[model samples]
Target: MKHSLIFITISTFLATIILTHQTSSIKCFDHPNPLNFHQKIPVNCEFATRSLKTKRKSSNDKFQIKFTCGMDDKKLCDKVQKGFESAGQIITSTISIEIPITIDASFYDFCKTDNQCSIDNNVVAGGANPARTIALMDEDGVERYYPQALVKQLPFEHHPNFGPFDILAKFNSEADYWFEGDDSQIKPEQADFQLVVLHELVHGLGFYSSWNDFFDFVNPKGLTPIPSVEGEVKENMEMIFNGFIENIFDKYLVILSSGEHASNITTIINTIVNEKGKFYETPKDFIVKFKSSPQYLQSQIMLQTATTPFALGFLPKNANSPSEAIVLETTLNPYQTGSSLGHVDYKTYVNTSDFLMTYKQDSGLTLGDFMSIGGNYTGGPIGPRLRQVLKTLG
Candidate 1:
C-alpha cells in the first residue's frame, strides 16, 4: 500500500471505490480498498489449479511455492523472481506450511508517464494481499475472516475459487531497487527488493488488520458495515451493507492503557442492527448515522484511541501478562488509512529485529544492518515478536 492519503468525498465514494476479488484475469495488487472493508463474496468449493511453474525448494523444506513473473526483460525478471524465491525460502524455513502457496508477482512502472516519475513522486514500492478470505468461527466462538493462505494451512474445509495461487503481489519497477542478492551492501539511495518482498509476503500471509478510518469524517467513526455485492458485472456492481465483521487479526487487539480488548467495542457495535438482523440498506444510509448513534458514540472511543501514540496493542494468544502485548502503529495524527493500524509502531520497531513490519523502510539499511543494530539476529527478517504473532494467527 502507498504511504500517501487520498481524500475521498461522499459524492465520489460510490463511483471511485470497488471491492477486491479474484476473477479469471489478473489485476493490480492494492490493499485496504475501502469498498472491500466488510465484503464477503461467495466462494466456489471446487478448486481449479492454475498452470504456473513451481519454484525449486530444498529437500528438507516443508513449505512449497509457485511463482509467476510478469516482466519482459529476462535478466531483470530472473533477478526479481530469484528475490521472491529467496524471500519465500526464509518464510518456509521459519514457519511450516503443509500446502504449497502460489504468488503472482510483477515489476511494473506504477507511474504511467515519464514525467510522473520525478523525484517528488509518491510511487508505491510494493503491495500484496491474499487473493481471497474465508469466514470461519474461531475457538472463542466469534466469526472472523481468515486469509486464504492461512486457511489452507488450517483444518478448515474452504476451497479457493480463483486457483492455487493464494497471494497476489506487485512491485514498482521504476523505483530505485537494489536487485542484487547480497542485501548487506545495499546503497543509501536504493531499497532492498528482497526485504520489501519479504515484508509484502508476510502481509499476504495475514499480518494486516481490517480496522481502518474509512468512515471517519471530522472525528473517528466506528467499524464498517459488512458489504455484499448485488450486480453480476463490474460496471453495474452495487454494494449492500450488512452486519459488522472483523478479521482474525483484530481479535487480539487491546487498549494498552486500560488493558481492554478491542473486540469489546466491536461486540457493542455489531449489536446495532434492524429487525431483519441487518445493519443498513446502503453505505450512505450507514454514514448518515455513523457518528450520531449512541452505540457509535461508545465505540468511537476505540476508533479515536487508534490515533494516539502507543495506545493500541496486540495481545498474542500465548501472552502471560498484559505487558506482553505488542504495540501497533497508532502514532499517525489523523489516522492515515492503510498505514496506521495495519503496521507496527515505527518508532519502536525501526531499529529492532521487528523492523520489517514498521510503517516506513530505511533506504540505506539492509537486513544485516538492522540485525547488527538490533542484535539477536535470526536467519530471516521475521523477528521474535512478529514470528510469534504469525504463528498465533494460524
Candidate 2:
C-alpha cells in the first residue's frame, strides 16, 4: 500500500511537469527561459558591419540646406552657393525634376580675428538641428580640421571628402589670382572645391555609398587649417587645358559652323571642367589633340557607372572629343589595275547627340553608322554608348 501510494505520487508529479512544458510558448534562443527550448530553436542573429543596399524612406518631405559663414570669410561661400545653384537649376531644367532638399543661405557672424575665423555650432539654421542631423564630426562633437598634415594622412593625399550634410569648405576668398583675363567661365582656382561639393550633393541624392564606405580615401592631415598656395596655382593651370579641347568644334571647322552651336559647346565644356577640376582636363586634351588617345575619345561616348569612371577609357585619346582620322586601306584588283595599294583619309568631328538620337529612334541602322563611317568595331560598344550619355548629360 505504501509503495503504490509513493509510485502514484511520483507519476502524478511527472505528468504535471510534462503538461506544463507542452503548453508553454516558444522562446528565441537569446531569451531567458526556464525550459530547455533554447537549444531546440534555430535563430540566426548576426550583425552586418556593411550593407550592400542603402535604405531610404519615401516621406515626400523636403530637406532644407542653409549656408553659414564668418564675418570676414569673404564672398567665397556666397559665390560657391551661386555656382552650385546654377548647376542645380540646369539639372532641374534638363530633367524636369526637383531634389527633395532645398537650399537656404545665411552668413554667420561669430568667428572673426586677425588670423582665422571660427564657427558657432549653437546657432544653427531653423531647419538644421545639430543633434538630429548627422554631426559629420567625431564622437566628441568636434569638427574635423583640414590641414596639410591631416590631408597627407589620408589614403589619397589631400583628396576631397564628399559628405552629404554639414560639410566644411576651406578655401581662399580671392578669385583674382585663380582667374586671368576673361577665363572666368570655369574659375580654375575653385574647380576641386566645386567638384567636391557636387560629389557630396550626389551623395545626398543617394548616387554613391550608403555609409562611410561611400567616401574616397583622403588624408586627414592635409585637410587641416593651413593656407594652400600651391593648390591655387595648380587649379589655375588646369583651367587652360580644360577650356581648349572642350570646344574642338572651332579649329576642326568640318562640324562647327554656327555661333549658337559654338556657344553651347563652350558652356558645356566649362561646366564639365568646373565639376571635374582642371587636373583631369589636361590629359583629356592631350588625347583629342593627337587623335590617338583612347581615354579622351571615350568621354565623348555615353556611358554610366554609379561608382567608377568606366567610360573614361573608351576614347582613343580624350574624354569628350570624337575621332579625327579614319584610315582605309584597299587591295587593287589585278584585272582592273596593276597590283597597287589604295588608301583614303577622312578627318572630321562626329556629333554624339545626333548619333544617340538616331540609335534610340532607329534600330536598323548599324552601330558602324554611328561609331565610325565604316563597320569595324573590334572593340565592344561601350565607348560609343558612354559618349552618347555624356553628351546628353551635358
Please report the candidate that would top lDDT against the real structure.
Answer: 1
In candidate 1, what are the lDDT values of residues 52-165, reduced to their tens digit? 333234445443445555557788778888888888888888887766676766666656622335345555576667766666667888777777787766643434344456
RMSD (Å) per prediction: 6.0, 31.3
Question: For model 2, what is the error of residue 3's alpha carbon versus the real structure, in angstroms, after optimal superposition?
Answer: 98
Q: What is the C-alpha lDDT of each candidate?
A: 0.63, 0.23
Ten residues in sequence with the least summed lDDT for candidate 2:
1-10
Off by over 4 Å in 1: 1-72, 112-119, 157-162, 182-184, 216-241, 274-282
Candidate with best TM-score: 1
Candidate 2 global lDDT: 0.23
Which tens-of-lDDT digit does each residue in 1-394 have in candidate 2? 0000000000011111111111112111111111111111112322223221222324332333455554454565556555455434433333322223443333332133223232331211111101101101222332222211122122332233222332222222321211112234432222222322332232122111110100111211100010111111231143132222211111111111111222232234334435544443333342233233333222232111111111111121232343331111112111000001001111111233122111011212233343454234333222343223222222
